[model samples]
Target: MEELTELVQKYSNFTQPMIDSLLTEIKNIQNNYSYRKFDVFIDVRNDYSHQAVVVYHKPPQVGVSLYQHKVVGKEALQENEPGVFHALETGLPSIGLLAETQENRLIHQRIYPIKFNDLVIGVTIVESDISNNILNSFRAKDTLERYNDVSATIQLFGRLDLAVTDQLVDSILVFDKLGNLVLANKTALELYKGLGYIGNIIGLDYNNLSLDGTNFKSILNHFLKVKVSKNLVEKKEFQYLDHYFTIRKLLNQENQQLIVLIQNVTEIKHKEAEIISKSVAIREVNHRVKNNLQSVISLLRIQQRRLESPELKQALNGSISRIMAIASTYELLAKQVSDDTNLASALNLLVSHFKQLNDTQNITVKSQIDSTIVIDSDRIVTISIIVNELLQNVVDHAFSHDQAGTIKLMGIIDHNIVTISVADDGSGFALDQVSTSSLGLTIIRSYVADKLKGKLKISSDSTGTTVAFSFNN
Candidate 1:
């Protein structure tokens, strides 16, 4: 056994504690059935095929040895010993299987999967005395009966394969037709322990188990009955012992069995709550900023009313427009569920405000925008200011007092590039007449070239003028 442990530790990925536990369990099994021989086999995968190697072998004292020679460290092909490979692959026990040993002696074997952390790490093979006919016949019959019972029970419970169920980290509870708890895996046991349960809980009636202040058994009973009439399973979440849990109900109609799957979602629920709280906090911040900007705008309006100089009033109004443009970005952000704003929507609001402020009844403003052009708040602010300056330039300089004209705002997206243009069909100016140092033009040029990393193109002739900006998506 010590030699076997050393080999297992060297070749397998199992920890030392796991190896010790396995050795202890194996010793207990050997001690309980002293009349029978036992051998432990581990599946090893090579480049070609899977092989089972004998790591430990114990022979019966009163019977003829199944193998005349030492069988430890022997390798058996998967095809030759199907029981070992079957238990390893299925994570289920294989009982009463007859197979030939390395020395050509027939042996009766019961192979059980050894599990750790919901994984099949190895197989434990129990060999009985095959030379005694009466004993062999009785053992084989009993094993076959037990296997049938287990197969039938599993089929009644939605045919859930124990091989897969044993590997799940979620706690599962299965109840029989009479509401007796029949199955609970290691995770389920640990979870029940956390709920203040002690000792073995198997074969207990569902209603007999005590849970502090929770009607868990009644809830299970209600769901089991409700599922039959409504054909709807209930899923619920609750807190138990400071941990959040989600319970799912599954019913097997054939035998009226019930299965409950419980998942601990404490961490996941906490993260969701944190995200929602952050979103609310950000929205409140945006609202406060918009209010503060509105207050500043109100103060500016009062100052404009008191000022007698037209030039000073005009300059104050320009500052107000720029501040309003920033406020509009925050307004859009406050109303949105996400951090991004629709460029078309924000620009449309800005354009409407400018038209009302300038009172442009002769110059008709038309917008041809791609509705899908949505951008983040920062880009929205920059683009809003650019559009505001361009539209102001057209309203103030493009048309005469008596002449009526059309100003068009165009936005288009092709492939991944975005292009926005402001064009006017009114009196045009020569390219050389437009000063680069002018405040409005300088703002537009600096924002386009520096902030947007885009190119600004201005074209003017005798008929019309157009300013277009192109940038990456």
Candidate 2:
């Protein structure tokens, strides 16, 4: 027999310790083969490709083997055995599904992951012949008979329904034309009993047990009068005393019986409500934060009016502009109630903020940001500050006296990389002549590296200066 350890070393990315531990697990699976009559095997993803390799196989002690020959060390292609790779990649089990064998035979498979260090190292698949169990699955579905009387329905379900309906997790309830409950499954009886219904519900009206209190006459009128299709199933959600449930209603035309399937979904409904509540709370908090920042900017402007030094007034204006840039991101997040904001809307808002403050400069700012670029609110705030610094730098040094210039801001995303570039139509300066330790350059570099985890590139010529930086989306 080929060793599992040798196969792991040759075809998989498992460590030596992991391989040693896996050997013990393989032995346990081999020795403890149960009476479920299934052939169990282990498969690992190939190190360099998407294919999976079978490293171990344990044939059932009493069951027939599906494989005609040894399948170890063979590549399990996705088209043949997708459950093996699905468990290996997603760390979730794929159960009770049909899969094709290497020898071109169909078999039922139930696959689960083998995890080491929180990573799925391999998948363990349980194989069984579909011919033995496929009859039960098909019979359970197509057994809805066209019976006329209650005695016929009772006789049919008593033999077969108990085996099939009890295995189901959803509650099954059936009612006659007079709104009398004709048949109740084990799951339905247990579910209603837990909901405070006393005694047997086999003869009780379905509306008496219904949480929504919809009468059988109303259900028949709504379904049969409007929808003539007998196979059509109507769905609705209802909540009763904190328990949320979804119901599927269908009518049997041959006997004029109403059938409803109930599935408890209270946990799913609560989770959806919690997410919406948290999103709204985050939006409210962002709105309050934006208001506070705007108040601070107003206070700074009032203080700037009292200052006499030209240099102090210019410094205050720069601070106000940077604060406005940060506030614009919060405004977008507050209105949309999300963690990310539209890049186009954010850039347009920044232009409006800068236009309000630029009284002396006749430069016009035009933003051509892509509408598809969505950035996190926190990262966009950092980007807004960087753009503000570069725009102010262009206005200060890129133009001469009485020169009309335009600053073009562009945001482009290509191949999962986002590039925000700013170009101006004014006099450009030599890179070597500019100070290496200038505040604008230092701020841009620090924000791009620390906040964005990206790279910065500045290219300048006699035409114009373009400062661009790129980050992964």
Candidate 3:
């Protein structure tokens, strides 16, 4: 049994040459066994021809040798041959006659099972005479099947797992504890530009690739700073035409091995730089325009007092003030191109200018303004005229009833249109009772409808009059 077990292990990977050697060795053993005991020898086996060899031990026959690899009948032993047929079919042991001829052939055959572990494999046919004892065949079979099961399972699972793993999507990679590339997926082939070093990392030893691991430590430091996921490492940075990546170390759930993921982030970095450059340019342009408009306003105010008539002097002063109001709005816009104009700041400055001009500190002006709106200079100029005209009307007519009242100025922007209102609390005026029309209100109406392309609404209640206007920029 032990001898059969040894044979099973040794000849597990059966080949044609090994089978020929086994047949010759058995024939020699049989001849020695019979000749020493009974002075006679007998042997039988299929030869190169389709016919079976049946020879008596007394005289050797002149024919094809039985030791040849090609066993004649069916490229193997004949399937109809009793012991050989059953042994090959079920990988089990059997014993039967080779031939029924008197002096033609009568041999004893014992079959020994070949196994990997507990699995049944094809049997080994041991040919001898009837006296050699056939009980050894069953014992050999029992010993062979004891350990072959595990070996068969291993072989089967290995083939199936390899087939399934080939169909994965992303390229998976593995590295040894020494940081050598060991395993890689099919996608890695395309990713590495066909460098043909998927499993070896091009033999780049850490000492060779990095000077005392400095390069590796730099990469580790970059990754720690970014702290992006191990799977999603962004531009940690760009190098020449390529980009270097930093990824966190991850442990594989099944193998507990370390891994890192790499990607390119060159495009996003370029876009961020472009946006910042454009914003800076925009802010600079806004600053220059604001400075230019303030210079023009200063020139206009200096020339206004030279006029002789009181009406001409007042008209020039009003125009200069409106221009200054718009310049103030631009000043705020130039400070933050990223933020926008502060309408409240512009309103406060406009009210302060009017109070200075009237030389009346008692006029209480309240303002409700949204500072976030980014209105253009043209819109600001138009809105300044509208507010100036409304406030002038309040100061001239609303307070003329021997009463002091508060004025409220509010501004709001929604979507692309900005709405502004100037209202005063005082006695109302009758359309039939009023005779003279002011040139400031006439210019305000023309600018709102034609130049600013806006709508205006004026309502006179018992408390006071409200002037509202909206324009698009």
Candidate 4:
């Protein structure tokens, strides 16, 4: 308890008295709920990251131990322990959040915020062992009750003299073997009225009902006569009265009766249409952006032809390459349905384009990029620029001797950090001789450190030069 208090004081701004009060409350909870393991965690806020540290732990007396080892100083990540953070963020108890311990054992956790003067300072988590048998037993009992209720409702409909209740949200109608309406709920009666029925539909023949000169009754009669397998259910959707409706047919024992259910799904259909409209709008925007960028590239090429100075032409070529890198991103985006762009595929495409455009007669370019690495489209542009600059540097300076060489681009992701390296097997330069003021190197450094929030490492020797960048995703 003393160590837990000191750890909380070291990580949080809560006073000693407040910490002591919280500890006492946790101990009382532990004494009350002796079957569950309880742990107190305080939020540790830092400039770079927000974390929670376990300040106190109490193990259960009669059940399996949730934590075999001490967690008095362990950090709880929001990703791994959402219930703990949720309680702290909302100041409300979070219940029944499933999680796995460091040892990979699944447990059910409930978290409550520890407050002092209406200000939440920490959270207390109650973890319990998950018993599958107990859960299955409760599920079975609930299922049985639902089945019994449905059976009772169906039996009530089997009696043709009874008037069914309209309490159900869905329209329910039961048809006899002769395609005669035996029972119809009030919702079903209202729907039939909309279909141009003027009188009682309880005794009306389904095959005689006319709907817009199309025997809609014949469709229902045909379904009633169709030999469906026992316990088989068929459903279909149609549009009516500017609303969407789903019809389901259920076959009872020996196909003696057919139960029809209708549900209105107009709101769900509207949501689906909205999603499609948004997708089409996004694709149209991508298409327009790509076309505009291509026009810019064409104008740059035309201007480059008019320039006679070699240095000016080279600078223009660099600018064109950067623009082309950005254009490639939109090109890929226009072709994809998803918002995330596969960085590996995009980088490979960029490398191939560079090799084809540049004058590398005997140079071989190889890529070891992971195809599974995908990132958002906005970040993809920065990554594309970074990759283009590093690869262009290799082509211009690494193999300036016109000797046969190889340039390899490798990318891998580890623990949410993406690492990309461009290595070349060419004449390497001394690190001390490299100028920090070089435009290409400076750009690479800026993009890596500032834009990506990462670090860039460049190593060079007689063997080769390898430039690597690491960033969090």
> Highest TM-score among the candidates is held by which one?
2
lDDT on C-alpha atoms for all candidate structures? 0.70, 0.77, 0.51, 0.70
How many clashes in each structure? Answer: 0, 0, 7, 0
Estimate candidate 3's alpha-carbon lDDT, on a 0 to 1 scale: 0.51
Give the per-residue lDDT of model 4 (tens digit) for 26-141.
Answer: 66776675534344333333213466777766666665566778777777765466555556654666555555565666666767677888887777777777688634533454
Better of 2 and 3 by TM-score: 2
Please say which candidate is ahead in lDDT: 1 or 2: 2
- Cα deviation at 41, candidate 1, in Å, is 57
Cα lDDT tens digits for candidate 3, 330-434: 566566645444566666777886786664455678888777765555566566667877887787678764456888998888887888898888777775565
Q: Write the per-residue lDDT of candidate 1 for residues 319-368, one digit (tens) a residue.
A: 78877877877777777777777778988888877775665888888998
* Displacement of the residue 73 alpha carbon in candidate 1, Å: 68
Cα lDDT of model 2 by residue, 44-103, tens digit = 888767678888888778867888899988887765675565466556676555577878
lDDT of 2 at 198: 31
Q: Which rank order by TM-score, best down to worst?
A: 2, 1, 4, 3
Model 3, total clashes: 7
TM-score for each predicted model, relative to the true structure: 0.56, 0.61, 0.46, 0.55
Would you list the clashing residue pairs of candidate 1? none
Tell me each candidate's RMSD, in Å, in order: 17.1, 19.7, 29.0, 24.1
Quality of model 1 by C-alpha lDDT: 0.70
